[model samples]
Target: MTLQLLNRATALWRAFIVLALLAGTSIEAVTQDNRPLLVAARKKRTQTKKSRATPPKKKEKAPEKAPEKPLEEKAVDLTELDQHGTNTSESYNRLHATQPSSTPNFRTYFDLAFSYRPGDQPVSFENFHSAFLLEYTPMAGLTFMVGLAPPTVLPLYYELDWQITDRLSLRLGRIWIPFDQINPHNTFGGFINTSLLRAASQEAFLPDVWADLGAAAKYDIIRDNDLQVESHVYVVNGFGQGGTDPKGESSSYPDFSLPVARQDNNDDKSIGLRVHGLYRNTVGLGLSFFTGGYNNQGTTNARITMLGADFQAYIAALTFRAGYAYMAVDLPLGTSRQFYTRGGLYTELTLRATDKWKLGILGGVQQNDNNVSDQNDRTIWGGKIEYLINHMMIVSLQYFKDLRQAPGKTNFDVALLRYSLTL
Candidate 1:
């Protein structure tokens, strides 16, 4: 019985050992089977974490593509609009607004005067001077002008201006050169209030036929509201101010009444240089110098030098002008040195009595050297009354007095009725 009991115990112990071994093997197999799956899951999780960390790079790339499409579309639309002529009106209006207004195509200015002098010719029309100015501007900075006057008394002057820049310009053709205050264009105007005509000194030395055919370049040193300076140079037939005159006239005629003076037939060519300055439009000053020579009959030559200065100022409605000039002539005859000098002062006061009626008082004095003894020093006074019919027309009456007179010689006195029109 003891041996059988021991055998049973041994068998039971062996069975228990075998079962434990089988359980161990199964656990080991299951562990091995799940090992690769666990490793694959962990790798997938790590790759997903790396992809999530790099999200900002994808987000950064997304914005770069959005602006390119809108910019290209806008460029195409602008190009189409430009090609279809939609941009014309604004440019056209801008160009049109910069143009000047059109006035009457045919424009003219004329002055008619009737003068009566004591113990002189009858009260006939002394001068019927008319200037017809035609102007055409093809572009903004270019202008063409043609002027006509009659009777062969004055030359027909023409002008063309091309403004290359705002402050620089070129002017060509025959222009009325400005050297002194009493010039050809301003001397014979019916609107001048002075009663005594231009001074005899100016008539003899500073004649009215002072024009030149040349080109001019103008530059503005100061173009502001306060100051201005302009320089001009000209090359012209320096026929001394009286234009060209025929040679050899008899000396039996009165010297003062002769058409050609002693120094008239001097030279054929000369150069002129002038500078003008203005301050506030109220003050004007000028300096001019001219040098040339004239050849007379035979080898006699007369060299001429002329220097002049002028000033003009307007203080309110009163205008004042003064001028002085020194002229020396070196004749081939002798060393006597013929000298001609003149000084003049003139003033005018304008009284606005009413909207259409105006009154002015004019007075001036002139002193001349080398004039006739009787006419060397003279005083002039005049008065005028004008009616403004409209913007384009004016009518005036004037009276003048000559204060200096000889005991027997008649001092000049005159009355004038004048009418002027402008278009």
Candidate 2:
């Protein structure tokens, strides 16, 4: 019984061993089948981990890309940009805000002259004359002036000039009658002509005074080219030939035969007209006509006419001027009538010896129709030397010779010293 029990145990043990072997084989097969799945699962888990890591790397790259861009492309704030733009605008406005100044509108000027002349004769005294002129100009188109001549000769005169347009003007006030080549104030200052002293033929008939107070209307026909035409119509006190009346009244009687005396028939007035023209600022021509009558015991009528021409020319630093005048007069048969015709020719030359010194020569001849009885044709020659201390002061020495004869008189010579000042 022991042997049989042992055998059964051996068998049971073998069977158990076999079953263990089979189980081992099945487990191996199963492991082999699952191997690929395990490897795939591990690969999948690795891919998922790699995807998460790459996402984080991508986020880092996005930040780095921003830094790599150009500095000029950086974003800015609109508010700061607007402030900068406003500041630039304000600066531009300030630079353009200031204004410029305006120009002056009016101007005034004055001229004054004073002269002292010493005569050559024993009976002569130093004569002093002075004039003052003031001018105001509000604009170029309008001007006003007041001039004064102190002492006995010329009275004060006022002038108004209004340029209505560029080409036309209206002038009014007392004006000097324009006739002779030499103005009253400019004719050797206070000296009279030799013809007057010798009583030339023309002097017997011609009027003596150089100026008269009158109103005139002048028109400028041509203005631009230094050529112009002017006409004047006026009425003045009757001609004072030989002497002036005590009351400064003009004569009314036109007596032609009366030599030393002028009778006044104060009932009549005289009218005169003149026309003048200038050419190239060098030449001038004028013509005049006058008519009047003296109402004495019998009414006496008279008529006078004049023609004149003047010339001025410049050669280098020297200037030359000359003029001629002619007059004719008619009087009633019974009334004292003197033939009236007078004229003169004059010339002057100025030489600049130095910057402050000047020398001049002057000569003139005069003829009279009435003074022929006294052989009154006269010739005048003079020379002057001037020294200039400045623009406003001058000293002049002049010598003059008169070639004319009166009754028992011979030619005369005069030396004059003149000092002048201008302000």
Candidate 3:
């Protein structure tokens, strides 16, 4: 019975060991699964605590945009005027430094006049001349200008003008003495108007381009009213009878009274006066007076006085230009006993038939009180028409008749065709 009890106890011990092993294995499996679960739970709790401790990041606001500008409208000014002061430069670059020369600004003109005279004529071609003008503005209110007509390369004038104020300007060097509108190679009327030929009386007593080494001052009234006023005063070396022109040629007979004086024979100089005005933007009037000693030969001394009046007005397509010049010479013919009076008159009218076509009529008379030469008391009348082929080309035809009526006079009935080109 005791042996039986021991075997039974061993069997029971073995069952107990298997049962304990199974319980241990089951516990290990449950611990392995529960270990992963507990670790995952602890990690989730740690993340939750970390999230609670951190603060939220703030958002950045974008910047606002600027407002847009309005579009500008372009325009054209009719009376293109800069009311700025004279000394103030018109260009910004000129004010800073010298003007840079790009393509230079220049003007050149060519004119050819072919004339046909019915009677005996010395030459076939009446006139051949070329004119050129070049101007450069180096800085503000400064100008250097040169004008030339060829056959003689000598410049017509080399003038320098300085603008001191808006209404005042000073000129030095050689300059055209301002007298009548035509004397300076300057035109009195619009394009397609005024005769291409100058009046005989106009050319009788002055150089076509009457320029001399002189000093001049010009003053403008700068008035608000349309009644504009300008005054010119100049002192020059004056002219000598039978002197030479800029072309270095002797003066012709009829042109003896009008000569350019390069050297003065006496200490006395010439004084010129001009008063010009305009009204209603259409009517213009001018008064001119010039006095100078004509000769200083000691035996023959003469004082010349020139009084001139000019008027121009435009009514629609019709334009009228008239001038009267009375020149008086107090000549000591024979030891202060006698003097001669010479005068001249000319008038012109033009009608614009079309925008590019012009028709004109002109009349002129010259009186020589001495009555010694056949050219004394001459009358001239003419008609002219010009068609502007283009802005740069013009074709003009003029017909004129000379009335001398003297016994040995050689009158002329002439026709002229002219081609004028401006570049």
Candidate 4:
């Protein structure tokens, strides 16, 4: 019985050892399978903590800006005005700073002159040649200009100028007739238009600042730094009878009253030619001729002819100018007189006292009709003092005394205070 009990105990011990070994193998297999999953969980936890520690970036704001101001236009250069205070084509183009190009450019300007005449009938204020000018350049060598006076639809002057070549030019429209030095070239020559002898004498025969509807050809015979010579030829509608006859009849006789006739009263047209030369900008000479029929009957040959010559000399601050004009009228069929003739002469001298002061004196004489010695002949003397207020403004005081008919007669006289301005 003791031997059987001992064998049973040994069998129980073997069973216990087999069970312990099986348990150890199962734990090792399970650890190998779950190793990758445990490592991935630890990395995810680290990334979450880093994201929480950092902050987002902020945006920046921009600063405010200031408002801009408007730009102003440039004014004309006043130092370029000639001795006559005139704005010639050369001076105008230079002061305006224009160039010839295919591109278009447009500009506008204003000029005015007004005077207080204390010697008129009941002393009055007068508005002279105030103008609003428009200039246009559409292409190289071409330009168009128009001048207007407000409230009057009529254009004061208008023209198209074409520069065909360096020395040749052509012009059309109602342009200033190239009849004399002052007529075609003078624009805004200070406040004293009456200060020049040419202005006083030419008004009796030719229109002051005479301009007419016409086409002109101008050629520069010689142009250089020290001298310039030019010639002009043109044809235009001549003068007409001053007024319609009282009986509403058209007379075949000539009209001595030469009125500006833009529209032709007759078929005949006027022709004019002028040649001018300037030396060193100090001395100038001009010669002009004009002829046309003034009778209402185009078939008749009643005509008027005029010849003019002018001289200018500038020495230091002093300037001298003189002019002579002669006119002849041819009578129509069956007239008592064969021809009527008239002539006039004038002289002017100007001294520049200072950069801002100028003094001038002028004298002129006119014979209405030399054929018939009547009291219509007249003489004139004038003096002017000009003060330049600035580059764009001028003030002038002038006096004119008329010596008419007889030497001892008390003739009319005028005193004017004028202002000239440009804008």
The predicted structure with the larger TM-score, 1 or 2, is: 1
All candidates: CA RMSD (Å):
19.3, 26.8, 16.2, 16.7
TM accuracy, model 1 = 0.60
Clashes of each: 1, 20, 0, 0
**What tens digits encode model 3's per-residue C-alpha lDDT throughout 1-423?**
999999999999999999999999999999887997889999999988987899756777778777886653332110011000111111211122244543234666666778775543533565445666676777677777776666656786777777799898777767667675553432222111112243332224345456777778888865557688788788876776553222222221123333333455666678998887878768888888888776664645567778888788879988887776777765444322344566666777878787677888877766555434443355768888888776567788887776756434453566778777767
Please, what are the lDDT tens digits per residue for candidate 4 over residues 1-423? 899989998899999899888998888888788889878988888977886786645656666676776553343333222223221233124322355654334333333334333323345566554556666677777877766655557775577888899898887887766654453222111212322222222223444335667788888999999999989888877766552222223344344333333456777889988888899999999898989887675456677898988888999999887777788876555655666776777777888797778888877776646654333355778788888787667777777776665432332566767676665
Q: If ranked by TM-score, best first, what sequence of candidates would result?
A: 4, 3, 1, 2
lDDT of 2 at 31: 90
**TM-score, every prediction:** 0.60, 0.54, 0.66, 0.67
lDDT of 1 at 410: 55
* lDDT of candidates 1 onward, in order: 0.53, 0.48, 0.60, 0.62
51-106 per-residue lDDT for model 2 (tens digits): 88875553344444444643332222111110111101111111122223221222
107-222: candidate 1 lDDT, tens digit per residue: 55576778776744557775545655566666777666655655545435556666788777666766545455443322211223222344322233333334446666666667
Report the poorest 10 consecutive residues by lDDT, candidate 1.
79-88
lDDT of 2 at 199: 20
Winner on TM-score (1 vs 3)? 3
What is the alpha-carbon lDDT for the whole of candidate 3?
Answer: 0.60
For candidate 3, the per-residue lDDT at 406 reads 46
